[model samples]
Target: MTKTDLRHRDVAEAAASQPMLQQVERWSAINSGSANLAGLATMAGLLADAFSALPGELALLDGAPSERVSASGQVLETLHGRHLRLRVRPDASRRMLFTGHMDTVYPADHSFQSISPIMDGRLNGPGVADMKGGLAVLLAALSAIERSGAAGSIGYDVLINSDEEVGSPSSAALLADLAPTKIAALTYEPALPDGTLAGARGGSGNFSILVRGRSAHAGRNPADGRNAVVAAADLTLRLAGVASPGLSVNPAKIDGGGPNNVVPDTAVLRVNFRPAGEEDVRHARTAVEAAAASVARDHDVAVEVHGGFGRPPKPVDPAAEKLFALVRECGRMIDLDVRWRSTGGVCDGNNIAACGVPVVDTMGVRGGAIHSPDEYLIVESLAERAMLSALAICRIADGGLA
Candidate 1:
């Protein structure tokens, strides 16, 4: 290896020994579930403190107004907790974006709150592999880069949002606002169980269709009442028929049914759709709107649809492929084999890619059972992936990824 390669390996090895798990343990102890505003605030503060060691102007940004339809058929605006931002050398010749989510899928009352060793070299917890571990790796990698005296060569913005678990409805604008300035992005989503990465990702959308109808007593004047529950059921089944080769539709739940003595006047259909590409996105939207209109007309109920596809499909284009190649090279330098495959899951990477920036998102620790109570992190990968990311950043700073 050359002198510079030897220097990178030394930095990687040094970063590998950092106290990554200590931070992961501390972070996983907090319950920063998507809907838990207070918990998210706590996590944000903790993250701000941890990330303050980096050189940058760090600030907390308010979340956008995210709309949702409540069970009462009333549209409500929900605000997410503050998201942390760190901007360094905004005018540098090369700019990069790094992102991670502070929220997990577990609620505040969830029973799985602490980390414990589950196997010979793995620890399981609520957010261990889903992303808290990833955040630890990100900090270690950036710290290594700074220590190696290459921090000034690149400009980067790190965004830690708190609502990715529920689909980043509030932080989507933040990702977009910083996308145009970035040539590439690295999102610290957990790597797959085998340490493989995700390349292209399918687009996802969550929707709630509210159906309004007249309520009447079940035993009397029932014929005069338009049952919104039945209308919602019909719409749900119709939505299933909209599924095809490139699109999957899931009608998750139907809310708003009351006592059996009365005809239900209001119902809401909660649906999720995944599109394989841009055309599928348009097709799915058109089909959903048309089906809602048809069901409303047939059942004599007024239907109001809320929510749209927030994440667009992410394709590994030429630019993204180049970055992947650089990461693979970095992995080889560290004696780690790196590979990637397409995934159906979506994240902030989709939004970043939509702005014409290349992103390699799953650069975190390796483990299995993400977003579950059994979520785990491989102890060895905590250091291994941190070294990988630090080397990647160093390579980028040296004009290798550019």
Candidate 2:
């Protein structure tokens, strides 16, 4: 076993000796969806209270950034809330930001709100992997960093946003604001079942295309009516892999239709594109616009596409690679052969990377099936990650790990 490996293991053990699991269970009990106004407020309050209990500078990021919340298949409502960004110390230069989202895919009234024991080693719960457990790890890791005589070494910041599950529409600006000054960032997103994590992510854009057309009787005067669904279908077919350059075009839903007797006057096509690179994003956006224009022109209907790229892809930056190497070295120092990889899943890391900050995601506890009721976090990796975080912070803080 390497020295860094042994040190990481010891630090992990030390962190585990604290009330880590208890804290995880505590946070896991809450359902904080981005759109759940009351729940989000409660969670923000809980986090503020928890951080206040600790010895750091804690405050609500009221001015950080926020937005109106919207749900799937529903009109948007005006709801204002912000992510919590805290800095333990302000004097150090080489800094790191640790980010986690309090939001989950599950709604406030979902039936699977209750956590259940699935097996000997797994506890299935909403947001357990998609990341309430990861938040627990973040808090615990920061706590250990403070307690392990390494507090304030690297001038770290922790940003816990409330809207990562819905593509981080509201929190992206806040993340970018916090990113420019930091040397690196560590995001608390759950690792895969085997503890692998994102090395590359596709930039995602969610679009709603609304088509306006004239309605008429289908059987009696089909030619007089414009079938918006048909037009939308045409648009969908055309948009599917239009550029095919590391971009995926997926048409998820068709809305605003009528019964069998009448031609649909309006159609809304929910289209989302994931681009493998930033250039792919630009190309995809142009293609979507062209496809929308072509459809509108051919069908003599007006179409509007709403929404843009929320977060860009976190390509394997050299700094990110360095941070990952440091984590791997820390793992070796602790005697654990860490398993990790890159992926196309988007997270708060995307927002951080958009800020031009180097980052290593999957710094949260190891887990699987995030954003699902079958979500589970590993019982062991909590401490491992905490330890790795501590060492990374210490090494980076103490003069370039030399």
Candidate 3:
């Protein structure tokens, strides 16, 4: 074998030797749901301790302040857990960003809290595929890179945030700040079960519209009352009609209404929008505002809109294509076939791409049925993906991607 091949084999072997499965088990055991502040704290602490094995300056930083509109039509500050940040070789000319999330879609009271082995080397558990396994792979790969002495020429910053499943409201700003400084970025969101990566992701926006009107007794003065719930319902239908081939709108829920004896004065409609591109995003926003205005005028209710798009659309630009090509080449060296296709799903990669950074986001384990009780991680992929990532990082450090 050539010297380069030998070097890659050594790094892969090193990555395979780490206790990645054990780490996945330990991390998945904790319920670090996005809204579970206490659980996220515990998970963050454990991650900080595990990631400390690498050479870096690590700290647990508070999440950015977040706000949300309540069901009662009042805006309230939302609390989020701390995020773990690690910076290694900050002065190096070639810098990269590695990102993952500690939060899972499952809450503390979720039934899928325990892990169990399934058939064919698969393990089922909460966040096992959608990212606890990914985190393990990331640690193993970086550790292998360090051992191979390949990280010296290229520095990397690691950010494992507490909020990602909930649209990254608290960590979006942090990601934006770090993304511009990196030449490339890798995010540990799981690959498909067949190991296909996600490319050219769509953007996501969440909105809460509050409707207010005058209340009166239903039986005696119903005609004198302007029903806010009815207005909110009208708004929901209008928003849904805004969907097209490029933009999808989901009016998820409406929160309001009281006893039938009186007209409800307040209601809040929660909706989500998925835009295929920047033009779609602009069209969706305009549609929302225009629909709200129409609903208000027709119902004689005051309408207020809150929230904006957190993840921008990620297109396959030339820089991103270069990064993907580099990863595919590394996968070939390891005897693995790496492929990617466009997906409607959005992640922090979308935010990073908005900052003009080339990022291959699905640098994680192969898995399927994410964000559900059936979520499973292919046990073998722990080492396989780790090797792929380590080789890619080593190549980037060697100036392969530029």
Point to the candidate with the largest lDDT. Answer: 3
Total backbone collisions for each predicted model: 0, 10, 0
Over 1-402, each residue of candidate 2 has an lDDT whose tens digit, in order, gives 657445545555665566666666777788787678678878888888776645667777652343321322233544546678787667776667888888888888887686775466776777777777777777776676566665555687778888788877776777777789888888888877676767877788888887878889989998998888899889988888574768888888877776999898788888888888888988988898899999999998888777788868878877777877877776676665666666767887887887777788787777887766677877777776676666666667655433
281-400: candidate 1 lDDT, tens digit per residue: 999999988998899899999999999999999999999999999999999987888999999999999999999999999998998898777889998999999999988888888887
Tell me the spans in candidate 1 whose CA falls farther than 4 Å from its real position.
Answer: none
Q: Per-residue lDDT for 235-348 in model 3, tens only?
A: 999889989999999999999999999999999999999999999999999998899999999999999999999999999999999999999998998889999999999999
lDDT of 2 at 351: 76
| lDDT, residue 163, candidate 1 | 89
| TM-score of candidate 3 on Cα atoms, chains taken together | 0.98
Off by over 4 Å in 2: 1-13, 62-80, 219-222, 241-245
Superposed by TM-score, candidate 1 places the C-alpha of residue 328 at a distance from the truth, in angstroms, of 0.7
TM-score rank order? 3, 1, 2
- Ten contiguous residues with the weakest lDDT in model 1: 143-152
TM-score of every model versus the real structure: 0.97, 0.90, 0.98
